[model samples]
Target: MKPVSTWAAMLSLSLAMAGCVTINIYFPAAAAEKAADRIIDEVWQLKPDAATKEGAPSR
Candidate 1:
């Protein structure tokens, strides 16, 4: 009886521990940096006269 209870406790503990695992995924730093730079450049490339030209009312 005691052995059975001990085995049950250990099995339950192992299962609980198994559910607590973590997996880490990594991104390549250089590629990520380059992508970020490209995005920043595109965001900053808006033409200064775009609003005036595009917002003018047409007859």
Candidate 2:
């Protein structure tokens, strides 16, 4: 009974510590979107077939 109670207490303490950590990350979503657009434009220029055609039959 003592071992089981001790194990339960230890488990509860570790679970409490899991939420105490801090993470900081910074990313420029606008800059990333601009870069992605440029890449897609370049790829589309290289392969015009990749562009979706207007008035095409929908799948």
Candidate 3:
């Protein structure tokens, strides 16, 4: 029971430290294009109705 409490305390401290740091990574345009293609393919595969709705002109 004592070891469990100590481990939990240590985990909380580690998580607090992890929240202090930030990371920003910018991907290249080619990678973004590939990802967009994949997302579009999946969305169209799952939701053709949504595709038609998006294509329709708004009044």
Candidate 4:
């Protein structure tokens, strides 16, 4: 019974320590900015609806 309790305590302690790990991730700002600009340009290049061509008010 004592051995089981000791084992349980160690496992809980190990799990608690495991939860404290830190992960560092780095993002490349230049690459992200380039990708965002490309997406924005593609979106802006799309043609407007036909209603707008006739001078109708766009919703």
Best candidate (score: TM-score): 4
Task: List the candidates ranked by lDDT, beginning with the highest.
Answer: 4, 1, 3, 2
Q: What tens digits encode model 4's per-residue C-alpha lDDT throughout 1-59?
A: 34568888999999999999999998799999999999999988878885599899998
**Taking the tens digit of each residue's C-alpha lDDT, what string does model 1 give over 1-59?**
34568888999999999999989999999999999999999989998777679986645
Query: Which scores higher on TM-score, 3 or 4?
Result: 4
Q: Per-candidate TM vs. native?
A: 0.51, 0.40, 0.35, 0.59
Model 2 ranges off by over 4 Å: 1-4, 19-24, 49-59
Candidate 4 ranges with C-alpha deviation above 4 Å: 1-4, 50-59
RMSD, candidate 4, Å: 4.8
Q: What is the C-alpha lDDT profile of model 3 across 1-59, one tens digit per residue?
A: 44568888999999999999999898999999999999998877875466568786545
**Total backbone clashes of model 1?**
0
Residue pairs in collision within model 4: none
lDDT of each: 0.89, 0.78, 0.84, 0.90
Q: What TM-score should be assigned to candidate 1?
A: 0.51
Q: Which parts of model 3 have CA positions greater than 4 angstroms off? A: 1-24, 47-59
Ranking of all candidate structures by their TM-score, best first: 4, 1, 2, 3
Task: Supply the global lDDT for candidate 3.
Answer: 0.84
